[model samples]
Target: MVAVVTALVLLVFIASFRFYARFLGRRIFADEEPGFVTPAHELEDGRDFVPTKRPVLFGHHFTSIAGAAPIIGPCVAAYWGWLPALVWVVLGTVFMGAVHDYGALVVSVREKGRSIADVAAKVVSGRVRLMFLCFIMVLSWLVLAVFAMAIAGLFMAVPTSVLPVNIAIVVALVIGWLLYVKKLPPLLPSLVALVVLYVFVWVGTKVPLDLADTGLDKDQVNLTWILALFAYSAVASLLPVWLLLQPRDYVNSHQLVVGLGLLFLGIFVAHPSFDAPAVRMSGDDAPSMFPFLFVTIACGAISGFHGLVASGTTSKQLDKLEDARMIGYGSMLGEGALALASTMAAVAGIGLVGFCALPGQGPVEDLSWAVYYDNWAHASGNKAAAFVLGGGAFLQQLGISAVLAQTLMAVLVISFASTTLDTATRIERFIIAEIGDALKVKALQNPYVATMIAVLPAIVLATMRVADGDGGVREAAWALWPVFGASNQMIASLTLLVLALYFWQRRRPVLPLVIPMVFVMGVTMFSLVLHLLAFWAEENWLLLGLTVVLSSLILWMSAESLGLFVRLLRERRAAREA
Candidate 1:
């Protein structure tokens, strides 16, 4: 069952990319200028805007945007059932998510590589751009703060990951030197780095470095790691694209391929059964599947964050304008592929490979997939760890050692998050510079100043002590996740709105973009209302207030977009009559 289902989902992705994507390219976004130079060449600075080959840029783009969300989102969303998670991820990435990402990349490339937020000034109005920038800033702030905490926590849980992850960084630096300075070919160096990466993955198992032994409590160690991670990301965000970000992400992309291949290959061999339900629509404990599922399984299907990454960094590195379709659409499919494997791991793969069963369930004959997902709370408890356990189990089927498999999975999670952390910081830097230009603050426009401003507050958010359950202190920024999903989707919908207007103004077919835009926007608005109610009932006024503000801004922007479309239609009608 696992093998067949996996093959079917893979087919959907392949077919969608082959047929659906081509239809989109020719019908909707037909403005591709064959000989046009991109901003990567027009504005090459050796730092942020150097032209890059498509394969290399695709790696950078994919890793930066993927992070752990694609894995975490689907794994957690399995609460409803693997069926809904799988269906949404596959369908969403194909129709809505890939379109959202591809549209933003193409639009940004045409607009001189300005972020979608900045491009808003051209598509709609300057004030709308301001509103968009504010949204970008808040989302970025939450991403940095939340991801730092996640990586720190992972480091504590999987101490074996500490060494290999760090080693990958050094390897990335070396690979960067080889690629850019030495002018070496990319394929051999990257392939070699991947092999070296796995070697250290094995070594990490033998030399696990636990921070708890250093005489600090869990919270203290977590905070220390968070601070250190921010410092590293700050430097990473400021470095030239060739030095660290690009080459490292390229390597991480390869890591993702190997990691994914393992999971799928495991599903094929193990052929696990579904211990979880096919369509778990309701439980007394689970949230309704209608709107929440859309947000819960957000990143793999359609994500606002992907649009940010596309316009923010990837747009500046296109070696050719044609690469947008492949990089933009292809990368989203890559993410969907990851999400699919994770869903299988949570459901059938884990059931076949085996998991550390629930507290009382243990390793009994009844230890099916349901033992791990019998309750919504259990499924939600440890998202990435669940994937690692199941995926690790799958690896074990291939004769890999349990310790090595788990360490490899842990390293993949940490690497995905780290790439996103630095990339988000860089995007935030761009946002800050754009914000500075808006406010006419010349100082904030400086890249150094912008990056500093971006990382510091995030560090404080991630490391700041707040009341933990029962009385201990912890970072409060992790609280932002509930709203982050909805807001991120909102970003995607609005990006589509911008694209819709871009096409509508030029007398092109917009139904393709509009369909997804409307659906995403509708679900996003619905999900935000539910989030607001939950926060209100829980008396989480901070989040409630934030949701209200975010909702109001989205509504205002929606209205603004509507007015622009209304005027455009009127003008078109008048021209038709004339």
Candidate 2:
């Protein structure tokens, strides 16, 4: 079943890229002028607007948006079943997610590489531009919390991954120096850096850096790591793109592909059967799979964050109009594949008997799908560990040692999360600076100041203590995920709205954009409403507060966009009558 499912997904991805993506680039976007110049050429700054080749830019874009969410979302969503998660990932990416990305890239490029938020000023209204910026900033804020929490938890669970993950930064730094400063061909240096990174994976096991050893309890240790991770994000954001961010992502891009290849190969070799049921719709503790599944698996399917990475950074370096299809649409396909692998990792029963303790429970003597996913909280909470351990078991079938296979999988997870962490923080810095210029706040316009503002709020959120069930307190990092996912889907839906409005104004065929727009918007709204009520019921004031603020933004901007859409229709009717 594992091999069959994996092969089927690969086939679908290939067909979509070859046919569907080509149709979008040529027909919908209508890129007749193959020689059309892009922002990378028009505003050729060495720092942000470098006219990058398709392959290199694809690497940057893929790794940036492919972050921990794709891996974690699908695996966690498997709390319901792999069938729902897999179907959403495969179908959603092809129709909605890829199109959303491709459209955002095209529109932002047409608007001279300004972010989609900035572009929203023209698409809807100036008021909407500000609203969109704030919405994106807040989403980026939640994003920082979610990914930081994920990385911190993974580090705690997979202590052997700690050392290699840090050293990957140093390795990336060297790769950047070689490519940008020393002017070397990228392939050789990138391959060497990747090799160096895995060698450190072995070394990491021998010298694992466990934060618990530093006299802090588990929660304290998680907070400590979040703080440290934010510090790194600050620096990564402020640094020039070519120096650390781009080259680091390049290394990780290769690292991700290699890791994923080995994982699937192992799955084929082991041919593990599914341990979890296909359709799991009922559990007293489970949220409704209808909307929850969509939000839970946002990134690999359709993510607003992908649009952010699309317009926020990727569009700036787009070398030409035609490249948008591959960079924008193709990368989402890559993430979908990542998400698919994560789902398989969660469902396969390759290592069925290992014992691991869940929250509020001792180690289960006979670990399996039932034990690992005994409830919603544990399934979602330990998502990274589930992927690492599950993927490691797959690799062990390929003759890798238990420790090494687990460490390798850990390296894969950390590498994915870290690249996204770098990109998201940089994007948030960009948003803060843009907001500063709009508001005429000189301090906020400063990059250093913007980076600080970007990092701090998330630090507070990631470190906050929330009252958990059973009269105990817990770190609020991962707890932010529910709000984060809802906010994520909301943004995706809004991006679709922006795209739908863009096409409607131009009087182009808007069905392709409208269908997904409506579906994702409905899903986002449904999830947010349900979450608001549940949060209020549980007295989860933090989550409730966040849901209220974000829901308001979604509703407000949606109203504004709808008004514009209606007005545009009236204008068309009047013109026809005249």
Candidate 3:
């Protein structure tokens, strides 16, 4: 209840600031010239820099920013208490997340779409740049492996949905090509494609796949498929905007907006009661504490991952730096809103029907590992059934048949995983490429070559997990979660540190950066200790190994920042002397 109230209060505060900040800032600085010129403006290419409508751009940015984590974290954390999840997401977003995301975008645009790695190289030291890249690369590989397993799990649950989603993707690609590459208007074709895709969802649902061969039902992370996916990303990211990434993202963005909108609508309409406690604490309580909370609610609140999107993707497409605040900051707020909506789902999506369907009598015990398969299946079935019926109402109005609606819903879910996979692979490849360059590897000097280096790690990691058998995906996810949370928070910490450093050097107000910097560092450090302690207690060697690696990386990064701080201080002292 406290968390819920806190979340609501912060949400209101951010929403107001997001609306009026730019207007006020613009009015106050009307006489001043633009602070920076984006690379897009200096070297405009219609391909990436084509002026898109604000709403359309918002849709794209929002979709790229929203991913499976928002949904999964909330769902998993719901087992603990929706109140903590909701409060953290809201408060964190307003204070830290929005600033990080918006700042990353604005900074990247001003720097001409150069990535954070490049930013570090220019603003800090080469070592710092290398650290940023290496950290991100590792992050990407973990993300890809985890998402691949997630997709596999979803496929195993309802194998019939996979083909429909794959088919929908192909159809989406065709629509994108015609619209962007062919220079045709996208409105009609996209609409038609969506309608047809919805139809496929309905028909595909009726076309049943035989589950008689239950042995095939088990999800084995096919390394080959994952590698193929990475291989595709290597080629895709290298391709022109008129091709893969742009088109896929465009379609995905539109679908995401619609899906999220409908979901929000459904939430408001159903207004289901919350079954979980407002502030239930974890047994060890370590995982949900300060440091872990920051990491656990990464994207839904503030994520370093968004910097990749802002610099790597969105900045390249900005027609004007003037729009940076809107695209960068506004997009973050939008993401925050999505996270809030997810929190609402976690809090209010459950009903008596869902509770009764569970294996155990109570919420806490129901979420335990001891929960049986029958209970899981029953709950999953009940929840899925309710969603299907609820989703049908909208689908029917959209002219989607009952079966098609289910297929469509499944397609959206699959696409989320697929897009996350491809995007994660590309990001990882970039990270490896940077590391290779740092190590003076000849192959990684070339972007294409570096991407290949990056792809291999993800492929190998995903494959190995698949080989581990039952709950391989789940196991892989658990292994990555702590590291992912830590690295994510570390990135947030770095961003705040950088902002603080920049502001301090400029002799401006440093409170904003200083406050967040200290808070996030506390969060990251706390989470790291918890993870290490858990590993020690359980004697989980894999986790222990992961914690060790992550701790080393964090220390290395911290050292880089401290050195930067000392260098800056000395420079300021010298400036005052002069």
Tens-digit lDDT track of model 1 for 188-228: 99999999998888889999999899899987898789888
lDDT ranking of the models: 1, 2, 3
Which residue pairs overlap in candidate 3's backbone? 39-112, 201-404, 202-403, 202-404, 291-523
**Comparing 1 and 3 by lDDT, which wins?**
1
Assess the local accuracy of residue 34 in candidate 3 as a C-alpha lDDT between 0 and 100: 59
Predict model 1's lDDT versus the native.
0.86
Q: Which candidate is the best by lDDT?
A: 1
What shift in Å separates residue 142 of candidate 3 from its native position after superposition? 0.4
| lDDT for each residue of candidate 3 in 1-578, tens digit (9 for 90 to 100) | 42344356545756646564454224421212455555666766764555554544554566666666665555445445666777777677666776666666666666677777777777777877877887777777777766765565455445567556566557756865786668777666766766666566555666644333544323333443454556666766666554555556666666655765665555445444554567655453224444455676778777777777776667777766566666666766766665665555444543312222231233432322123112323222222222333333334445545455545555655666676566565556556665776788867767677667666666666656421223333355435665786777777778667656655665655565567777877778777887788767766677678678777877777778778888988998998999
> In candidate 2, what are the lDDT values of residues 126-179, reduced to their tens digit?
888888899889888878887888788879877899998998888888888888
Ranking, TM-score, top scorer first: 2, 1, 3
TM-score of 3: 0.82
Scored by lDDT, model 2 comes in at: 0.85
RMSD of each: 2.2, 1.7, 5.3
